[model samples]
Target: MQLRFTTDNADAAVLDVEVKELVIAGWVGRDRAAVLHHIRELEALGVPAPGAVPLFYRVATNQLSQQIRLEVVGEETSGEAEPFVFFHRGEYWVSLISDHTDRHLETFSVALSKQACIKPVAGHAWRLSEVKAHWDRLELRAWIKTNGDWITYQQGALSALLTPMDLLNRYFTDRQVEEGFAMSCGTLSAIGGIRPSSEFGMALHDPLLNRTLEHTYITGSLPVIA
Candidate 1:
């Protein structure tokens, strides 16, 4: 997929990124309890502990999508949309992505669940430099449309997750994603327990800049034949 981003700086030029690969980075929360809560959920589903908080999963580049299809019934799904970051032209660009997963498969194979569905991504992004200074001023939030109303599913400051520079230094020290790769920086715990929804919305808000990058998509499920 192609991502187009513009900075809050009116003089900055628009950035066009050709997405080549996706690495769903997980367990990247500042609050260890938040990270543990996710691990515990996976454990309940039978996924073994990895002895770590931050981990990475290679997702097929084709699985990336602007819309998501839920192709199974027994699948318990949830959207872990967070502030997505990628590198380009000697800088990092920020966007939004949902690490949509099959909660059922999460028990048996976190790897398989990671590959099961198309990840949802926003079409627009922002320059990381624009927000890096007041990084804590950035906020991330997600909502699920239910019963004709938008309900808050997840919400928190970007500070809750690792900083973009740190994540890059630790995992992509060699600039693995330098040519253009995107990763979801973990997520906030769901307001309610994780559950599937037919529609989802997400946004990255910079109160300091008084700007927002937002998008919403409808989820369609295909059949799961047993």
Candidate 2:
């Protein structure tokens, strides 16, 4: 699927560029305890804690998804509401993505668990510059469909996570986001313990800009045939 971006020339058509690389920025938070809370939450599932602040793992461009399917039964998964940023044409564009993850595998391998699920993301995006100034005003949210009802799974201010600039500086050179590099910058905590859901909805709302980037997808679990 092609990732779309807004151009500097409002009159010009939007750019639809294929991503070259996919970067997953983990443990991205302003506070160490907050980061650890995420790590410990996973640790409760037996995933070892990382001894560091900004952890990153690379995923193939093909793992990027608009919808996702998983074949592993007993594989609990959850949608982590996060800001998706991709660099193109020497600029950064923003979108929202549900960092669909394998909770069962997390205890065995965090990276493998991350790579195990297709990353569901929105096709539309806004220019990073357009929302940088009032960045804190942006809110991130996710809802899980439980028992035929949509229940809020995650919700919080973007301010709770690390600023995009802070993340870029820690993971990239010169604090300049390179073209074709995409990162699903961290997520907010869950309302209840993480669990699987048939449907996951995510959004990035810029109240200051009075706009939002949203995406929703159905997660179909394929039979785990051994």
- lDDT per residue as tens, model 2, 1-226: 4666554456535877788888888888778876777777777769878756788888878878764443334448767889998887788888888788888787888788888888888867888888888887899989888889999988889888888877878887656565678888988878877788878888888888687888888877766677
Scored by lDDT, model 2 comes in at 0.79
Count of clashes, each model: 2, 0
Which structure among the candidates has the greatest TM-score? Answer: 2
lDDT tens digits, residue span 1-226, model 1: 6666665556556777777777777788877786787777768768777655687787887777764443434437777778888777776788888888888787777778889877788867787877899987788899998899999999888888888777766776664556677777777778886888878888889998788888787776666787
Instruction: Flag regions of model 1 displaced more than 4 Å.
Output: 4-14, 67-75, 174-177
| lDDT scores of the candidates, listed in order | 0.77, 0.79
